[model samples]
Target: MTAIDWADYATGDKNAASRTLLMREFLRRAALWVDHLGGSERWPFFDIAERVDSSVRADPDLLERLDEFTNANVPEFIARRMCRAAVHWAELRESTEVTLPDLPDPYEPLIVLYERGGVFFVENGVADFEMRRVPLRTWQANLAPEPVVEIDQAVLDAANEEVH
Candidate 1:
């Protein structure tokens, strides 16, 4: 006979546990937003999204399980509440302009952020990310000559090359 295991209940078994998990995820995304980016002067929201995306890319299953988890555990009220809260926290949540940083314009979702950098990116609907050519400054020393840290425009031109 198989041994009994009540770990599911203790760990997370019922509707309550599911809602908690969903809310947590929603909250996490909310926190990434500029509006919810903590009630103070914060850096661009998209900048934070970039880091978040890179980290999340590791566990790709999270997105796949999201629907099953949400529908089974998360109620319409929870989803609505979260969406409403997100909108209330930041108008962009409601507006179509919401996006992540590095993507100057509003975008569909983070999936796009991973794709063509041209696509606009969204993060909790508060901020937007746009693609821009930034100089890859050298971390050589505290103070170096101008050429040592010169702004190279060729980087943008080479983005399409994808090879040396």
Candidate 2:
């Protein structure tokens, strides 16, 4: 009854295909439920929300940090938090609902496409590694490009040398 099964569709236009967020949640939750309970998994999103919300609330200390930074615990600090919480990785991050990253340059349609769960350059036939997850804070449904080119390495080096 699910629209897109993570185990089924390896790649697709998530934005174009998905009608509701529940469908996305269903995929991850079903996979987890299948591994945990059995019955090959059934309706999942509704079942898992309670557990997920409870788990997230139990750690309110990080609520502000997660809300503000979109990164509850960066890779560098996650290990320490996991050890402190005595929880594994899946339990640590509440939602697989990935955060979107800011595009490198707005003008680059390729970057926009990549961020919107679409890719033209790299064929993601094997994985739906949503590139938007790269920059969680920069959330915008539409692409508005403002391009800025960084100075050349030589100029950067000269500036650095003067400061040093």
Candidate 3:
């Protein structure tokens, strides 16, 4: 499908007819975008275009319908993004404050600390062997030791030989 230059709609006279046409166009584009993403199932996003089309055909007071839709408290973000408009939207009715669930910290498991002398430390098991050490004893003691595993010397030597 050909892309319509939405900027064209923004130009010209700012009358009721023009506004209605622009709103209808925006709703159509939003419906197409919704269909492109996935057909409406849980949410009836695509139905917006049909409803707006009906309103346009009926030549009703779009501003009143828009106010009603806005008062219903649908997400403004989705409309703003899909409609390609820079206009500020106002809600006619006051909306209740939404309480978001507290999110858990992703880095909670790792211990982060600074030594008294100013050396920083991380207590996670993972370590970089190539880390530079100014004080050898303190660094060695703090780093978790690699577990020893028994292996036949001859078999190990043969495996290393194959890799080389």
lDDT of each: 0.28, 0.28, 0.25
lDDT of 1 by residue, 1-164 (tens): 01112122222112222222222232233333433334323322233333323232212353345444444543333332232222233333333444534322122222222122211222443222222212211112112211111112343224334422
Candidates 2 and 3, the one with greater lDDT: 2
Q: List the lowest-lDDT window of 10 residues for candidate 2.
A: 134-143
lDDT tens readout by residue for model 2, 1-164 = 01112132223334422211212222332344334333332232123323334343335564444433423322223212322332222242434553213222111221222233322111222122333222111112112232222223443334334533
- Model 2, residue pairs in steric clash: 100-135, 101-135, 106-145
Q: List model 3 lDDT by residue over 1-164, tens digit each.
A: 01222223222222222222222233333334344434444231123223212222212365445445434432333332222111111111111332212321111111010000111111243211123111212222322222111123343334334534
- How do these models rank on lDDT, best leading? 2, 1, 3
Backbone clashes per model, in order? 17, 3, 0
If both were scored by TM-score, which would come out higher, candidate 1 or candidate 3? 1
* TM-scores of the models, in the order given: 0.22, 0.21, 0.20
Position 27, candidate 3: lDDT: 30
* Model 3 CA lDDT for position 147: 16
Off by over 4 Å in 3: 1-14, 41-164
Runs with alpha carbons beyond 4 Å of true place in candidate 1: 1-13, 34-99, 102-164
